[model samples]
Target: MERLNGYKHLILGNHDRGHSLAWWLNVGFDEVSEHPIIYKNFFFLSHEPMYMNKHMPYVNVHGHIHGQKYAGVNYFNVCVEHWDYTPLTFEQIRDAVVPSEEQA
Candidate 1:
């Protein structure tokens, strides 16, 4: 909390250990919710991806399925591989999972 000088934060609720820690620590969060977050772009941060049909049009960023599993759906798995967080961007996610115009 002290480390971040000028940045806003948001917290979502789920049955995850890390998220629980973050909710307790971070103080800059503008909003907190038990439901999924929907910003200009959505990042579904969860320990795992369950049945998330409501969060469509917004990509889901989960971290339970080990290794990279790019479902045709807009879901990005950020699970740990050998104790590391594999960072990914929305563009990368769109390119990998979203099909080209011809395919779409």
Candidate 2:
């Protein structure tokens, strides 16, 4: 994290071993949450592809959908399999904003 000079946030998964938000914060994340974390009107970051009301005004950027990415407009899968074992990049997220696209 120091190398990147970036703010890292965490959304704990169902099986995550980390128990305290403060612990994760001390470990380097700028923020941590057990539920989806909303950013601007464009991002909803989460561990699982949370079941939100369709009326939600933001998009979900999530993991836990291990094999296949969801084929929907309101959610973006950051799961490794969706990205060929690599982390999703900012460019990838921008590309994925298109309703019919996913790869980056």
Scored by lDDT, the top model is 2
RMSD of model 2 against the true structure:
4.2
> Candidate 1 versus the native: TM-score?
0.48
Q: For model 2, where is the 10-residue window of minimal lDDT? A: 95-104
Q: In each prediction, how many residue pairs overlap at the backbone (N, C-alpha, C within less than 3 A)?
A: 0, 0
Candidate 2 lDDT, tens digit per residue, 45-90? 8887766677877678888888787767778888888777766765
lDDT of 1: 0.55
Compared with the true structure, all predictions reach lDDT values of 0.55, 0.74
State the weakest 10-residue window (summed lDDT) of model 1.
Answer: 8-17
lDDT per residue (tens digit) for residues 3-104 in model 1? 544443433434433565456545555445555554546555544675558446666766556666646376767555723644455566567656688335
Off by over 4 Å in 1: 1-23, 26-35, 41-43, 53-55, 67-72, 82-84, 100-104
